[model samples]
Target: MQKLTNTIFLLFFVAIGQGQALPNLDSLLKLVPAAKEDSGKVLLYINIGQQYESNHPEIAKQYYREAGALSRKINYPAGIIKYINNYTFVLNMQGQFDSSLLLNKQAVEIARETKDSINLGKALFNTGTSYRVRSDFESAIRYYEEGKKVFERHGSEETQAIANDILQLLYYSLEQFDKAIEYGTAAVTYLRKVQNLPFLATAASNLGISYARKHEYEKAKALFNETYNIGLKIHDLNAQGSSMLNLGDIALQQSRYSELEKYFSKAEKIFLELDAKESLVISYRGLAIYYLFQRNYPVAAKYGEQGLAITNELNLAFEKRKTLETLSSIYIAMQDIEKGEEYLRMSTRVGDSLLSETIQKNTIEIEKKFEAEKKETQIKALTANQKVQQLSIERKNFLNKILLAAGAAVVIISLLAYRNYKQKQKIQEQRIAELETEKKLAATEAVLKGEEQERTRLAKDLHDGLGGMLSGIKYSFSTMKGNLIMTPENARAFERSMDMLDSSIAEMRRVAHNMMPEALVKFGLDTALKDFCNDINQSGALKVTYQSIGLENLSIDQTTAITIYRISQELLNNIMKHAAAKTAIVQLSHSEDTISLTVEDDGKGFDISILNGARGIGWTNIQTRVEYLKGKTDIQSAPQKGTSIHIELKTS
Candidate 1:
């Protein structure tokens, strides 16, 4: 029953308009014949399709088909995309998951080509719902999260609410009940605020299911009643039917047999009238259980068989297994041992088959997702490689031009050799100064290496020795606390001492981690940088945004990673300490033969020439580290404008 729960979530969509009357289906049909052959006609067909989507799916599909044909005839990609997106909802209602997925993917491509992000979000949300229906929960969750972000950015609260509702059901399917409740409750709240009563009822019904699973029956009951009232007020048959089924389920659980029959009978009548087979299965299952409890073996068996048949037609493996189990119990209660045995065996087979199919499908979906990601990565890599090659060619051309000019100047220099003899003395002095500068750089590198070595040793000592001892002491204090009897004041003091020790231990670990991040030593630079930025952001200090690519997979040596990490750390520290920045961005990117580090902050800046006499150790460290790596650093700043520092290092 839980497996079948929320399965029909994809069947209904939140209608867009508020406070506007829906167009009559007959009126829209009449106008379609008189409308001109243009985008307006296409939109009319779409509107007709939506009007029929909830109650008359087949008619809706036909209308969407006509809309699509008209759009293509007019060479209107946007119209085609719109119709396809609407059309997939019908496919979803019919349980045509793979077909719906294909159409949604096509819609995504079309939306992208048109650069329509709102439509793109809709397409992605539809795709995710299709995947959720197919039990590809990983893909479903990824797309839903992405689609939610896009909708939020575009201020499409209606679509966002729809996506959130699907995510709630998806998380419930994945057995992540907390996340299910969170998303489900949020969706209901938002839908209620927007007065989308149909979807608000749906979301509340879904959250009720999740709460029931969590054994929070009081909360579940409240949600179900709320949905039922809203559904009745809106005259939404689908919403009313679903809420009644849920309430009937709750009544059955509570053994309120009279209330159960009343709810189930009403829901069954509604579903049967609408021919909503997907939802009718729920009523059948509830009736089967209700009749079984009343000792009506024949009626219970009949209802179970009906639900089983519908589940089979829908290819709902979990629901089929549930029905089989219910039937087995019914026969067993009736003393039909042979029939019970047969049903039990059928249930077992269905369960095993469902498990196997789920595993296979999940494997295939993961492989497909990874393969697509790999292709995208390769394309990006190729593009970056082409850019690098183009720069190389340009640099070579520039060098050749310079060489030609130098060759022309050589002839003139030969004629002016005596005049250059005086410049040779100055050239010799400059050469000596260059040598001295090189020696100073080497000395700085050695000093930096020593400092790093000392830091490493100190970090190790703190983590392995002091940290361990502190942890042991804290544990000992905790163990001693329960055994010792003291005055109330003494107990309070003892608790304070233990708390202080815990804080001390935490501070020690933080220091050790900063000195030499364990993630940097283990998972490499990207994880370390991300962790660092996440910590800063979590601290409620300056917001630090970090983005890195290829650092994990590029196979840089440890020394290079640490050097680059230290430079970045110094830059972030400078921003936090003196930049007065509200936000900063740290981006580390890598190419085939080069790595670039960029740190920018929206803060008060200084003259670019400040480095000439600047004494700040942070800036000095950044420059020294870059020099040590034989890299170049560019610092751009103005008195009031923000600062940006870019460092590029050769991999070789």
Candidate 2:
């Protein structure tokens, strides 16, 4: 359920909007027909598309494409921008980022022409998703925040809901679990409508994931189950399968293979029926891992092959690679080292290609989102100023009339003087609030720039200063040691020292990589995460398992990744130090909407309530780290029962 809970399920994620409340396309058109003008026709199509986008994306695409065409035909810049916003929603669902970006480009062009603050905000928000899909968190967050400012002006519940949800996701992805939960809780205010049930389920599920990440298994499980209930109510099979998969994943991490088997089976069965290839692949792979954990080698091999076959048939390179990776692991366990190595090679090839493509896409998406947000902010400021000025004149005119009326009806005015005074007072307060909010936006603009500059500085410090120093030290040590020969005992000691030095250097490199990954900066977070996890798990002291659900790629920001790493580091360190645990499990999973990091330890357990509340250094650090990222955390522990931490962040 937590896995199912993120963007599509949590953050205004409508791969297409679900819910029976959505009007049918024909019904929508019949209700809001074209008004002859090109703008009017485009608007009609947009409305129809919203109606059909969930159930019939092809139909939605037709309407949206038509709307885009009509807007261009009429040179109605507003229409063009608005229609494209609608179209982008569909594009995100269809995983057509390229087309989405193209349309978003057109929308940006029109927003510039019309200076429509509202549509500019909507377009900016839509563009954020394009960036998010490409895994460009910085750009995505930038646009989302920019959109929030625009939406704040309009103050529509729906737009505010969207912004709040995006913020929740941004925080979650960053591993600021507490802030993620806090802001996510704030989102519920605007997303109060039951029609937004799917979104609520996602948030709740994400809420659960965050709790789980903190090792609050009970709380996490509860939220997950709640999310599942909503999915079932909506008859959203995709959500249902995803929710179950996460729960199954939890079971797997805890070595509750028996339980995992059941959940995975149910999830796979549903996904198989729906032909949901992505989910099926995830479920089957999870099943294979479960079987392998139980030493049911034959079953593990069977499911691994099955999952691999489907991924290959679909040409889903991502899933295909994952399945192959599992197969390789299975073979290794079965002592078929050569076969294992072969599968590993195939997995690597596919993974490398995916990594390269993902990086390019994420970089481009971030650029587009940044540009779009910059444009949106300027327009929003200008529009806000104009609105204030217009309102000032309207107020003056209204006051003059009110004075004249009051003079003529002094007795009536006196009778309602308190009400009239209160009304005026309320208006004045609202005006002051708006002015203050505008001030904040101005400040935010400066802050955003400052943060980027700071990151640039920090990256330089880590790469040029620390990294160079480490390289120099390593080279010097190597040179001094190259010609030295010694007694066997002395040689062994020297080698051990060298090993420590090497390990320390590698550790520093990992830190530098975290500070600024050339690959992440080059390719994006997904591949970097996969490679990093693989590297960590290869030591064999731990089992780090990961999966992705709906997203072909996750767009995320650098800060978000850093925060996640820090949180994860804290988790792993705690497990290693205190758990006396024989095995550790880590998973990177996402759904149509969200991405999360989960670590479970089958080590010594302590009462989770007491330990988490103890304010120990590790506890505080994990909490602080998650909060800084504006995410949520859950921790679970019990004596002789192991410990598990689940953290889910909402991402759009």
- Can you write out model 2's per-residue Cα lDDT over 1-652, one digit (the tens) per residue? 1133232232234321222244455666775543685566676778777666544667878887887788778887876676677677666654568788777766656775787777777777667767666656777888777777877886566656656665666676666778877776666554655457766765676666666666677777776677778778866565567678778766754657678788889888877765556677778888887787676878999999998888888787867866776787677667676897798789778866876675555456555655676667667666766776676566556656777667656455444654655576578667656665554444444344344444544565455434543453444445546667788998888779878877877776666665555665567666666666676688676666655444456677765665565577668777777888877777767765556777887888987667635868778766755555456777787899898788877664
In terms of lDDT, the poorest run of 10 residues in model 2 is 1-10
What lDDT is reached at residue 463 by model 2? 58
Q: What TM-score does prediction 2 earn? A: 0.51
Residue 289, model 2: lDDT of 79
lDDT of 1 by residue, 430-548 (tens): 75566556655655665665567557756865675456445544554565576789999999999899889889988999999999898998888888889999989998888998998
- Quantify all predictions' global Cα lDDT against the true fold: 0.77, 0.66
Candidate number of the best lDDT:
1
lDDT at position 300, candidate 1: 88
**In model 1, which runs have C-alpha deviations exceeding 4 angstroms?**
1-4, 10-21, 156-160, 311-316, 363-652
> Residue 282, candidate 2: how far off, in angstroms?
0.9
- The number of residue pairs in model 1 that clash at the backbone is 0
